[model samples]
Target: MQILLLGGHGKVALHLTPLLLKRGWNVTSVIRNPDHESEILALGKGLKGNLNVLLSSLADVKSAADAQKIIDTVSPDYVVWSAGAGGKGGPSATIAIDQEAAKHFMTASFASPGVSKFLMVSYLGSRKKQPSWMSDSEWAGVVKVNTEILPTYAKAKQEADEYLTALAEVRKRDPNASRFQAINLRPGTLTDEPATRMVDLGITPKGRGSVTREDVAIVADLLLARSDTEGWIDLVNGEEGVEGAVERVAREKVDAVVGEDVEGMVKRFFPEAGLKF
Candidate 1:
């Protein structure tokens, strides 16, 4: 399999590269800096996958047409949007790379003939409204970060996710559209801890928590292999094994929610839970 991985220099993407390579899948990693080419190539040194570095910046991709041109050249079977502005270029930069570039690539993917699967590494709290089950204190903290700390970054991710969800819906109704599947792997606060290979993956919120970058990479690899898994997934460090958690979530269909509705969403996953809201 061939995969086009955006944000090749990212922490998560770097960790994910080896897993894909070990599977003998060819990966074309797109990076803005040419210096990082050797670093990315080094990951596939002993692996079977072919590594190709595309010297391009996501900021330059302004339109769907521009993104489509890159897609046409790569002709990848899967696309991973792991790139972000990282707050270096300010709010406008965040919107340009995170929101606009992401949407453009996704839109381009819908038209690309070879692209079938698109994976987005997003934040677990990337939503317009807080979940109903979240405590007031927790929600307040999240609001502070979203409004004061990283407001632009949060908004960019939220908008990008919404755009992807809308595109998935449109594709579902249009039979003539290219056959595609999109997975929004929303991981909680990311940490540089070691890989535990254990996580809580589901549609419902798993409260505020931190997940290891390695574990997130593992989950991304697993999700890519499972063709039946699509839609948004909430991920965090938990007791369940990554493989089992992914299998269970993939077997059971859970609808993604944007509002603060808890009862309906919870009951769908845990029908016997008689807890009162």
Candidate 2:
């Protein structure tokens, strides 16, 4: 499979690239800086796959022309949105990288004939409705999650996730004719701890929790390989080991195999996840 990744230097993307490479998949990473090229290369040093770099800034992808340029440059089977402003950049920066960039990528995917799937690396609170207790001004303010603004981050993600889910609805209604499919992955608070190789996949975990960045990458890897998989799913540290979760996910037969409706399709593919339109 040919995969294109945004945010090439990100912690999760760095881990994901090597895993995809080990599976012998052709990978193209769109990176803003040339300096990070070596790190990506180093990951694939002894791996079996080919790594290609496309130098482009996600923030600069604002127009159809920009979208077309990306489509033509990297004819990808799957596009992974892993890029973000890392919360250091203020709200404008977050809107640019997280919302606008993600929208442009979806547009670019539609324009690209080779692209089939779009995977979003979202967050735990992304789908939450704006709470009645929090006023607009208060919600928009920088409420920190660690050093990042929790509300701003969640709002940005919510907008992006909503847009993709809308597109997914249109695709599902006309699966054979739809241009591409999509899946939004919302993982809980992230930590830099080493790969746990275990995760809880659902709408929300048993409770609010955190997960290792590496474990999220592993889930992404499995989801990418399952073409029939679509829509949103949340990830967190859980009782099931990563290997077992992956096996269970892989074993679930999709609609093509079972002659089922869309709801059944989603339930079988992501039994633990909450279903959206």
Candidate 3:
């Protein structure tokens, strides 16, 4: 498959690009500078020829148009956005990259009549919750860094997901809507370890187990192979020799839990299969 990797220099994309190459998929890595462009190429090492590198600032105004042009030119089978801008100015930067950039890229790709799929990565826990990031005080870095503005990275992600969902719905209503399918993969606190595959790392204040970048890539590739996928879905690594039961639930079950229940569930499953959102 022909694929585009947005923010291709990010850690996840670093691992993601190589794995995609192993699956025999051609990749176009997008970055902000020529130096970053060369660095990624160098990292490809032996897998060199399988990758195409591009340089552009997704934070700029023209990014949307430029991104759209690239999409039209390559006409990729899939687009993976694994880039993130966090810390201090992270809120503003994230708003531009995660939300504006996401919209531009999604609109650019999905707006076409023949585009295949749009897969993005977002945080898992807050998918269904409001931007309680500032309120919680638990996720202290985001708010304190920006101080007055209280950068809302979580809110940016949430808004972006909602926008894509709406766009997909609108596309379906029109008989001649775009053919592209979109799905957001919301993985838990990402880790570099390959050992924790398919397990949910209790996403809480204290944090829990870790989900590796390799695992998230596995889920993204799976969705890209299919034409039908949507909304926000959770993907994690399940432990070996541990065939535990993990089921999907309705929104009602989420609302059924009390505040304390959340903490208890989080602590209990932190060491086990991980907690549920």
Candidate 4:
């Protein structure tokens, strides 16, 4: 299989690319600097396979053409968008690179022949305003959780998530359209430890689980391997001492804070009754 990675220079992508190479997958990394072209090529030769890099940058939305060009050449089986610069930025910079650039990548994936998998690195708090995630002041906490790059990054991720969800639904209705499978892989906090087991996705992280980049590589493999139609998969890392994982821990934390969805938290707080959304 061929995988085209955007922001291959990213921390997580660095680990993921090598993992894919080991699995005999061809990789074409997209980056803004032509300088990175040689870097990924060298990394590929080190791993042993046809690893290529295309020059592109997500910083400027106008350069979206660069992304399209790379997509045209690679025609990969999966397109992973890890494209973003980390650091403090206001909402404007956030939306430019995070939201709009993401849109460009997804659009290109749709255009790619035979490409069906579109995976993105997203956070859990992305949908706090929606009934599906939470209600009340819980939203403020969610905001902090998702806003790794602060408000700007959070806004961008939120917009991108909603947009992709809508796009997936449209395709689901149109069978003639490509049968695309998109997933948001949510890891608590990125770490650097090597993966020793399959991800514990059944539970939320136990107190902000931090996963190593190696662990991220494992989760990415699981994500790319699964062919789930359209849904969100939260792979919160960390264990409660021996047995329980984050998901199990989440039930306790959420229940302690405001209780479960069974308590009518959805209707009581952010009611969808009056407004036609």
Candidate 5:
């Protein structure tokens, strides 16, 4: 399999590249900094899969056409969006990279014939409504982050997730559209801890918790292979093995967006985009 991974220099991407390479799946990692090329290439040094680094800035990707060019060049079977502004360049930067860039890629993926799956690394609180399974305290914490702490980042993620979900619906309704599926892996607060290979994955919230970047990468790797799974998966550090958790979630259907219809969601989240059914 050929995978196009955006944000090659990210911690999660760093962990994920090795896993994909070990599986003998060729990966084309996109990074803005040329200096990181060797570092990423080293991860696949002795692995079966070939590694190629594409030096490009996601901020420079202005539209779907710009993103489609990259997708066409790579022609990957799977595309993973791990890139983010990391809350570094302010609100505009967050919107540009986290929201706009992500949507561009999603739109481009839909148009790309070679792309079959587009996986997004999103946060656990990337939704406007709280799930019924979550407790009051848990929902409050999520709201705090979305409304105050990382407001811009949270809003960007929320909109991006909504847009991707809407696009998935569009794909289902339109027979002529490309068959590429969109998957959102929403993990809890991230940490630098080692991989536990254990996680809680499903549609319901796992309360307020944190997960290791390594564990998230492991889950991402597994999810990429499980083509049967789609929609948003909420994850956190837990007792269940990663493989088992992923398998269980794959067997069960996850309605990522609840309390809102697809048409309403698209209209509310993307009023100006003019997304056609």
Candidate 6:
């Protein structure tokens, strides 16, 4: 599969690109800084994979038209919306990069041909039950650090996630209306620790949680290969191993077909096989 990742220099994307490459998938990362090109290319060193780069910044994209130009030019099979303004950028910058640019990407994806999948690496708090980041206390400490921009970043993510949900609803209501498919993975407090390669996922997974950036990339890879999976899945570190977790789900009995059919899809990167949507 071919994947285009925005915010290619981010911690998660940097780890993700290499993994996808090892799996024999093509990866193209869109980045704002030309200087970071070497770092991104370095991930593929001695690895068998194709890595491409596109020079673009969400900050410079004024509207959906600007975003469309990039999507049209790349024409990737899948798009991963991972870009953000980071801590240095102020409120306006946060809104521009996180909220407005995300909206533009969604609009562009709907219009672009050959771009059927969108995988978003969102936060655990970005959901309908709690839309804005300010509404959640997880960011209380960050607010004190960058008083002007921290809260704004949360609000920006909230709005962007809402926009994605609305568009997803449109697709669900009229499957034939659009060929695009989107899934948002909302992971709990991200840490820089080594990956556990295991995750507990659902609309709501019990217990306090955290997940490694490397593990999040693995989940992204699994989801990308699964053509039948869609919608939001709350993620957190879990007891089961990464491959084990996916295997368990694939083995669950469903009325649609015999055991072998489900196993075939799961072994080949399909999830929730033989289950109703």
Per candidate, the number of residue pairs that clash is: 0, 2, 7, 11, 0, 0
Name the candidate that leads on lDDT: 5
Cα lDDT, all candidates: 0.85, 0.73, 0.61, 0.63, 0.87, 0.71
Worst 10 residues of 1 by lDDT: 268-277
Q: lDDT rank, highest first?
A: 5, 1, 2, 6, 4, 3
TM-score of each: 0.90, 0.80, 0.70, 0.75, 0.94, 0.79
lDDT at 263, model 4: 25
lDDT of 5 by residue, 1-277 (tens): 9999999999999999999999999999999999888899899988999999999999999999999999989999999999999978889999999999999999898777778899999988888777788888888988998888989999899888888988887677666665666889999989998988887777655556889999999999998987788888888998899898888888877655665466877666556653554
Q: Which of the two, 3 or 5, has more lDDT? A: 5
Q: Write the per-residue lDDT of candidate 6 for residues 203-236, one digit (tens) a residue.
A: 3333235899988988888877776656665678
Per-residue accuracy of model 1 over 1-277 as CA lDDT, tens digit each: 9999999999999999999998999999999999999999999998999999999999999999999999998999999999999988988999999999999999898778788999999987777676776677777777877889888998999778877776676666565666688899999899999999988887545446799999999999999997788888888999899999999988985445546333443344335533221
Q: Candidate 2, TM-score vs. the true structure?
A: 0.80
Q: Candidate 3 — which residues are off by over 4 angstroms?
A: 43-49, 88-90, 128-151, 200-209, 239-277
Top of the candidates by TM-score = 5
**Model 5: ten consecutive residues of lowest lDDT:** 268-277
lDDT at position 141, candidate 6: 36
Residue 109, candidate 6: Cα error in Å is 0.9
CA shift of 220, model 5, Å: 0.7
In model 2, which range of ten residues has the least summed lDDT?
Answer: 253-262
lDDT of 3 by residue, 58-141 (tens): 777345576778787667778888876754355677788777888788777765555667778876544433233224543343
Cα lDDT of candidate 6 equals 0.71
Candidate 4 regions off by >4 Å?
Answer: 34-39, 46-48, 63-66, 88-91, 130-140, 145-149, 196-198, 202-207, 239-277
Residue by residue across 101-213, what tens digits does model 4's lDDT show?
Answer: 88777767766667888988876555544333344455555656665536767777766766666555555656467678876666666766666454545334332455666
Candidate 1 has what TM-score?
A: 0.90
